[model samples]
Target: MNAKPTEATLADRHVLYQESVQDVEAEIDFVQETFQALRGRDAELLREDFCGTANTACEWIRRGRAHRAIGVDLDADVLQWGIDNNLARLSAEQRGRIELLQQDVLTVKTDAPDMILAMNFSYYLFLGRDELRSYFRNARLSLKDDGILFLDAFGGYEAPMELEEPRECEGFDYIWDQASFNPINNQMTCHIHFEFEDGSRMDKAFSYHWRLWSLPEIREVLYEAGFRQVDIYWEGTDEETEEGNGIYEPSEVGDADPGWICYIVAEK
Candidate 1:
């Protein structure tokens, strides 16, 4: 008889990644509430750039009957996986309200949306200032006249360090490896790996070669891209535990922790 498969061997990287790296529920909550608070109206259409697996887009569709989402990505396989797994779980009406476009974000054209999301630090892939700015400009053009762009960024003293951090997950261990970094260019190579108790490992399940952009730099580029305003939403600290309290508010200052993640909101 054939031996049983280890969890790592049987696991799907996309599924594991969704479980470990993404919280679409919280993300959508922030996006929706922030947009309504900033714009004084509910946002109807949302565009998700570099939307792997279209998880967030699906979540947006499920939020309301009028809510619609467009997910754009260059990876066809991942898009298909999202259709098969994530989208498949949605009701037919929900699926109809969302679209997954296998197209490049910089050039893809679609109906103007009320907001555009470039989350998961995916835009970090643009290594050059000009390239990154160009992408931002393109994103701006794809939005409504009063549209807003939402992006998540991460950094701190430890961002450029070469290190590996392991965290316990449901049935396996997730490891984030900062495999390499170059301070002079602010470029880095990072990867995610999964390990199972059965002594099996899924190495390099996801890898990224990205620039470590600073908040000032990102704000400058957004302004250069013609955004009327930009704000950094810093996470609040839990008074009791002194950890992030899961509430992010617009702030001009943030703690210089070893590592941290924050959101950038740019209004057109």
Candidate 2:
């Protein structure tokens, strides 16, 4: 049997309420700012697919008077987690501007949005061409004429096996784990495990089964899905920056680095 979904699954209210809100806030801001730069205007409405805790949605509201966001996911528990954890930080005015729905990205629909983002490589869950194409179609139909889709991707020859990386949080240890890999199929099992100072551990705080998609395949699918253009934003090499230097410029080709992470933006 498949491993039970992570506690970070959308319906898990307690975990969402307990997640790192500040880190999430920065990520949402980065997306919004990037979208604004791409569109040459402020993006007022955002649709976040595979939004687990809806923390991004909450941040969108807190950032401005005009912002509004809708978070979509199939799990209900995690959606409630956002409400209990992240939403509580917002004022009543901000709360009204954000909404979370338990729905699948494969079927969810909304008005033409100024921008759409599927962050943390969430779209990788669809391992088949047809399923992924259908998702791209859904995203296209949901975007405004000038809207853009932003997605994150990572790749490396060394990526096809088990790996473990750790980060030290303020009072806890966070682990990003790639426990297994199927090289023949590119299907992998991964998760995040958290260790608190008290020595208690939350194994599999978040886990996912995803197909590792390459840059070329992503470009081809975007074109086939009717996107006007697809461009990449590559990460710059500078070990000095805490998060590493990244620039969101237009590029048709990426570097041949052993491992790389980048974003693909598809214009509608």
Against the true structure, whose TM-score is highest?
1
Q: How does candidate 1 fare on TM-score? A: 0.99
Q: Tens digits of per-residue lDDT for model 2 on 29-85?
A: 567777877778888888888888777677777778998888998989877777887
lDDT score of residue 117 within candidate 1? 98
User: What is the clash tally of candidate 1?
Assistant: 0
Query: Which residue pairs does candidate 1 place in steric collision?
Result: none
TM-score of each: 0.99, 0.86
**lDDT against the true structure, each candidate:** 0.95, 0.78
lDDT, residue 135, candidate 2: 96
Error of 1 at 228 (Å): 0.4
Q: Pick the candidate with the highest lDDT.
A: 1
